[model samples]
Target: NAGVIQTPRHKVTGKGQEATLWCEPISGHSAVFWYRQTIVQGLEFLTYFRNQAPIDDSGMPKERFSAQMPNQSHSTLKIQSTQPQDSAVYLCASSLGAEVFFGKGTRLTVV
Candidate 1:
């Protein structure tokens, strides 16, 4: 498919464990965006990168959340010492111009 691909559609982790989510953007896209969705907060922007360079990550948690784009084809989001509060559907999107394409997302559940 032409859409972004997110791995492990569902994940279960123990409290204090680490969780890493993977995303592969569309082949020629220049920008990738990461977001978190939960019942309390509807779709919150976490971070984004343009040309594989991080632009902003203000919405990302300072302590445990981290994102990286090692190359143009893919990006990753890692959450260290995951907590119950960190449970949410993490979305990955890629854009070329005005329209953005999104993946099914990785659902993280911390217990």
Candidate 2:
């Protein structure tokens, strides 16, 4: 309910390593969105959750990308065996369709 909190605003991960990002959504807003932005891909929708339930995750990579919302307020995105292409700004947003707010995001750099 404190809006969205993203820790370690910047992160550097070695290739094949793991990088975990956290998110905290606004109160009363049941819809949370995850997106990855890069120079090549632009803004890509990773996944979304509504009412603490996964509504759509079709945009997520089938391999190492994973996301979850165990409660109404927070969610996490984990990348296992991250690759160089995974480097991007991971943003978390919350909305009710009419309005949406995004966090500053974690600038992930894979080296």
For model 2, residues 30-77, the per-residue Cα lDDT tens digits are 899999999998999999999989999998998999999999878999
Error of 2 at 94 (Å): 0.5
Across residues 1-111, which tens digit of lDDT does each residue of candidate 1 receive?
Answer: 668999989999999999999999999999999999999999999999999999999999999999999999899999999999999999999999999999999999999
Candidate 1: residue pairs that collide: none
Candidate whose TM-score is highest:
1
Question: Runs in model 2 with CA error above 4 Å?
Answer: none
* CA RMSD per model (angstroms): 0.6, 1.3
Tell me how far the alpha carbon of residue 19 in candidate 1 is from the true structure, in angstroms, after superposition: 0.2
